[model samples]
Target: MKIKLKIWRQRDSRSKGEFKEYHLDDVSKDMSFLEMLDTLNIKLIKQGDLPVEFDHDCREGICGQCGVMINGIAHGPLKNTTTCQLHMRSFNDGDTIHVEPFKAAAFPIVRDLKVNRSAFDNIISSGGYVSVDTGQAPEANSIPVTFEEAESAFDAAACIGCGACVASCKNSSAALFTSAKISHLARLPQGDKETSTRVVNMVNQMEEEGFGYCTNTEACQVECPENISVLNIARMNYEYNKAKVLAKK
Candidate 1:
C-alpha cells in the first residue's frame, strides 16, 4: 500500500509549524502505524532529512505513550484503539493522511507530533496516590473488597493517562482523566481515607493546568482509548460536593 502523509512539522515549541507532505510507498498493510512511521523515518535518515518526531513505548498499546491526531481524530479513526495498535489496513492505498499532535492548551507542541504532556503528571502529583504506611504485603483476604467494588476500581484504574480525553474535547477538558483517578481510589476501601481531599485537590490542579471545564458533551469518553466512561466525572463531582458540604460542618 501507498499513502501521502501531510504531517505537521515544527522545529521546536518556539518555531512556527506547518504541514509538509511526503509520499510513503510499498507500506505493508500488516504494519502498525508506528511501524510505518519507523519505515518513513528510515527513509528520511537515508536521505539526510530530519525525521518526524512522535512518541511511542510498549507498542502493544499498554503504555499509552503512543498518541497523536490522525486525520483530526485522537489515535486515528478506530474506536478504543491507540496509535500503536492502529494498522495500515485502516487506510487505503493513495490515501492522504493528515497527522498532527494532540491539540490542547495544556499540551503545547514540543516538536512535530510531540507535545508536552507533563501537565498531566503535575495533576497526578497533586493527589493521585494513597498515603498508606510502608509495611509487608497484606494478605489478599484481609481487605475483603467486594467483587463489584474491585471490578469498578479496576475499570477506572485501566485509564492510561494518555490525554485522549483532553485531545477529543472541544473545550479541552481533563475531566475524564481527573475523574478516573478519583473514581479508582474512591471505589477501593484503602482509598476511602483520602477520597474527599483527593477529589478536591486533583480538580483544583486540573483547572490550574489550564484545561477547560467539562460541559457534559461526552466527546472525551467517546475518544478515550480505554473507553473510560463519563460517569467517572459525575462520581468525582459528587465526591467533591460531599467533601465541600462536610467541611462546612
Candidate 2:
C-alpha cells in the first residue's frame, strides 16, 4: 500500500513539535503497524535521517506500550485494538495516516512519537498493591471469595496502564487507569484490609499528578485495548467516598 504519513516530530519535551509528512510505497497489507514503522525507519536510516522513536515491548499487544494515535483515533480505528496488533490492511492504498504520540499534560513528549507516562507509575506507587504481611502462600480456598467477585476483580486487573485512557479523554483524565488499579484490589480479600487508605492515597496521588477530573464521557473505555469498564470508575468513587467517611472517625 502507498500511505502518506503526517507524523508529529519533536526532539524533546521542551522542543517545538509539528507534523512532518512522508510517503511510504512499500507497506505490506500483512505487516503490523509497528512493522510498517520499522520499514519506514529502515528507509530513513539509509538516508542518514533520524528515525521516528516510538515505544514498543512485547509487540503482541500484551504489554500496552506500543500505543499511538492513528488517524485521530487512539490505537487506530478498530475497537479495543492496540497499535502493534493493527495491520496495514486496515487502510486503503492511498490513505493519509496521521500518527502522533499520546497527548496529555501528564504524558510529556520525549521525542517523535514517544511520550513519558511515568505519572501513571507515580499513581500506582501511591497505593495500588497489598502491603499487608501475609507471610506465605495460603490455600486456594482459604479466602472464600465468590466466583463473581473473582471475575470482577480480574476484569479490573486487566488494565495495562497504557495511558490511552488519559490520551483519549477530552480532559486528559487518568480516572479509568487509576480506578482500575483501585477497584481490582478493593474487591479482593488480600487487599481489602487497606482499602480505605489505599483509595485515599491513590486518588490523592492521581490528582497530584495533574490528571483532569472524569466527567463520565466514557472515552477512556472506548479506546482502552483491554475494554476495562467505566464501571470501575464508579467502584473507585464508592471506595473513595467510603474512605473519606472512614477517615472522619
Candidate 3:
C-alpha cells in the first residue's frame, strides 16, 4: 500500500524544524511502523539523501523510545500502543501521516523524531528510588505483601517512562509519569520509609524540570502503552500533600 509521510526534520535542539514530505509506494501492511520508517530511510540513503533520524530499541514495544506523534496523537491513534508496535495496516493506503517528536518544554528535540528525554531520568533520580544499606539480598518472605498490593504496585511499575503522557497532555504535564513512579514504590512496604521524602522531591523535581501541571484531562493514560492508571496521580497528590503537611508539623 502507498503511504504519504510528513516527518519533522531538524538538525539539533537549537535548529528550526519543519515537516518534509515523502511518498512510499511499497509499504507493506505487515510492516511495523518502525519497519516502514526503515524502508523510507533505505530509499532515502539510496537517493543520496540523509536518512531520517528516530530512536528505537527493543522494537517489541517495551523500550518506549520509539514514540512519535502521528496525526497529532502521541504514538498514533491506537489506544495503549507504542509507535514501534503500530503496524502499517492501521493506516489506509494514500493516508497522509504527520510524524513529529514529542513536544514539551522538558523534552527538547535532539533531532527529527528524537527528543532529549533526560528530564525523565532527572525526575527518577530525584526520588524514584528507596535508599538502603548494601548487604546480602533480603529474604523475599521477610516482608510479605498481599496480592492486591503487589498487583497495584506492578501496574504502576509498568510505566516505561515513554513521555507519551507528557506529549498527549494538553498542558504537557509529567504528572502521570511522575505519579506512576511514586505510586509504584509507595504501594510496597519496603518503600514506606522514604515515601514522604520521595513524593516531595519527585514532585518538586517535576516542576523544576518545567513540566506543566496535570489538569485531570486523563489524556496521559489513554496514550500510555502500559495503560498506567490516572489513580496513580491521585496517590501522588495525596502523598505529596501529606508530606508537606507533615513536614510543617
Candidate 4:
C-alpha cells in the first residue's frame, strides 16, 4: 500500500513550522503506524534528510507516550486505541494522511510530532498522591474493599495521561484527564484522606496550565484511549464543590 503523508515539521519550539509532504510506498498493512514511520524515516535518512521526530517509549499502548493526530483524529480514527496500536490496514492505498502533534497551548510543539507535556506532570505533582507511611506490605484482604469499588477505581486508574482528551476537545480542556486522576483516588479507600484537597489543588493547577474549560462536549471521553468517562468530570466537580463548602465552615 502507498500513502501520501502531510506531516508538520518544526525545527524547534522557537522555529516556524509547516506541513511538508512525503510519499510512502509499499507499506505493509500489518505494520504498526509507528513502524511505517520508521520505514519512512529510514528512507529519509538514506537520502541524507532529517528523520521525523515522534515519541514512542512502549509501542504496546501502555506508556501513552506515542500520541498524535492522524488524519485530524487523536490516535488515528480508531476509538480507545493509541497511535502505537494503530495498524496501517485501517487506511487505504492512495490515502493522504495528515500527521501532526497533539495541539494545545498547554502542550506546545517541541518538534515534529513531539510536544512538551510537562504541564500534566505539574498537575499530578499538585496532589495526585497518597501520604501513606512506609511500612511492610499489607495483606490483600486487610483493606476489604468492595469488588465494584475496586473495579471502578481501576477503570479510572487506567488513564495513561496521554493528553488525548485535551487534543480532542475544541476548547482544549483537560477535564477528562483531571477527572480520571481525581476519580481514581476518590474511589479508593486509601485515597479518601486527601480527596478534598486533591481535587481542589489539581483543578486549580489544571487551570494554571492554560488549558481551556470543559463545556460538556464529551469529545474528550470519546477520544480517550483508556475509555475514561466524562462522568469523572462530574465527579470532580462534585468533589470540588464539597471541598469548598466544608472549607467555608
Candidate 5:
C-alpha cells in the first residue's frame, strides 16, 4: 500500500521546524513504524539527502528511546503501543500520517523527530534514589511483601520515562512519569525511609524543569505505552502533601 507522511524537520533546537511531506509507495502493512521510517531514510540517503534523525536504541520498544507524535497523538493512534511497536497495518492505504517530536517545554526539539529529554534525567536525579544499603542479596523470604504491593510496584516500575504523558497533555505535564517513579520506590520497603524527602524533592524538581501541572486529563495514561496508572499520580500527591503537612509540624 502507498502512504504519505508529513514529518517535522528541524536542524536543531534553535531552528524553526516544519512538516515536510514524503510519498512512499509499496509500503508493507507488516512493517513497524520505525521500520517504515528506516525505508524512508534509506531512500533519502540514496538520493544524497541527509537521513532524518531519530533516536532508537532497542527496536523492541523497551528502551523508550523511540517516541514520536503520530497524527497529533503521542506514540500514534494505538493505545499502549510505542512507536517501535506500531505497525503500518493500523493505517489505511493512501493515508496521511503526521510524525513529529514530543513537544514539551522540558523536552526541547533536538532535530527532526528527536527531542532533548535530559530534563527527565534531572528530575530523576533530584530525589529518585534511596540511601539505604541492603548490602548483599538476601534470601527470597528475608523480606516479605504482600502480593498487591509487589505487583503495584512492579507495574509502576514498568515506566520507561518516555515522556508521552507530557506531550499528550494540554499542560505538557510530566506528572504521570514522575508519579510512577515515586510510587515504584515508595511502595517498596527499601524506599520507605526516604519517602517524604523523595516526593518533595522530585515534585520540586519537576516544576523547576518546566513540566506543567496535571489537571487529570488522563491523556498521559492513554498514550503511556506501558499503561501506567494515573493512580500513581494520586499517590504522589498524597506523599507530597503528607510530607508538607508533617514538615510544618
Candidate 6:
C-alpha cells in the first residue's frame, strides 16, 4: 500500500509549524505505524535529510510515551489505541494521513512529532506518593479491602499518563489525567494517609501548568488509549471538595 503523509514539522516551541507532505509506497499493512516511519526515516537518512521525530518507548502501548494526532483523531481512529500500536492495515491504499503532535499549551512542541510532556511529570510529582513508611513490606491482607474497591483502584491506575486526554479536549483539560491519578490513590489504602492533601496539591499544580478546565465534553474519554473512564473526573471533584473541607491546609 502507498499513502501520503502530511506531517507537522517544527524546529522548536518558539518556531512556527506547518505540514510537509511526503509519499510512502510499498508499505505493508502488517507494519506497525512506527515501523512505517522507520522505513521513511531510512530513506531520508540515505539522502542525508532529517527524519521525522516522534516519541516512542516500549512501542507496545503500555508506556504512554508515544502519541500523535492521526487524521485529526488522537491515536488514529481506533478507540483505546496508541500510535505505536496502530497498524498500517487500519488505513486504505492511497490514503492521505495527517500526522501531527499533541497540540496543547502545556505540551510544548520540541521538534517534528515530539512534544515535551514533562508537565505531566510535574503534576505527578506534586502528589501521587505513599510516604515510604518504613519500606518494609506490609503483610498482604492486613487491611480488608473489598474486591470491588481493589478493581476500581486498579482501573484508575490503568492510566499511562499519555496526555491524550489533554490533547483531545477542546479546552486542553487535564481533568481525566488528574482524576485518574487522584482516583487510583484515593481508592487504595496506602494512599489514604495524604489523600486530602494529595488532591489539593495535584489539582493546584494542574491549574498552574496552564491546563484548561473540564466541561464534561467527554472528548478525553473518547480518545484515551486506556479507555480510562471520565467518571474518574467526578471522583476527583469529590476528593477535592472533601479535601477542602477536611484536610488541614
Top TM-score: which candidate number?
Answer: 3
Predicted candidate 6 versus true structure: per-residue lDDT over 37-121, tens digit per residue = 8999998899899999999999999999999999998899898899999999999999999999999999999998999988899
Please identify which of the two predictions, 1 or 3, would achieve the higher TM-score against the true structure.
3
Q: Give candidate 1's error at residue 53 in angstroms.
A: 0.6
Worst-scoring 10-residue span by lDDT in model 3 = 240-249
Q: Compared with the true structure, what per-residue lDDT tens digits does model 5 show for residues 76-143?
A: 99999899999999999999999989998899998999999999999999988878557887687877
Give the alpha carbon lDDT tens digit for every residue of 139-240 in model 1. Answer: 889888999999999899999989899999989999999999999999999997899989999999999999999999998877888999899999999999
Report how far off residue 177 is in candidate 3 (Å).
Answer: 0.5
lDDT of 6: 0.92
lDDT values of the candidates?
0.93, 0.92, 0.95, 0.94, 0.92, 0.92
Clashing residue pairs, backbone N/CA/C < 3 A, model 1: none
**How well is each residue in 147-208 modelled by candidate 2, as lDDT tens digits?**
99999999999998888889899999999999998899988888888889988998899999
lDDT of 4 by residue, 1-249 (tens): 998999999999888899999999889999999999999999999999999999999999999899999999999999999999999999999999999999999998999999999999999999988988889998889887899999999999899999999999999999999889899999988997799999999999999999999999999888889999899999999999999999955
Off by over 4 Å in 1: none
lDDT of 3 by residue, 1-249 (tens): 999999999999999999999999999999999999999999999999999999899999898788999999999989999999999989999999999999999999998999999999999999999898989999989999999999999999999988999999999999999999999999999987799999999999999999999899998998999999999999999999999988955
Q: Which structure is stronger by lDDT: 3 or 4?
A: 3
Which parts of model 5 are misplaced by more than 4 Å? none
Q: Give the Cα-based TM-score of candidate 6 against the true structure.
A: 0.97
Question: In candidate 3, which residue pairs get closer than 3 Å at backbone N, Cα or C atoms, i.e. clash?
Answer: none
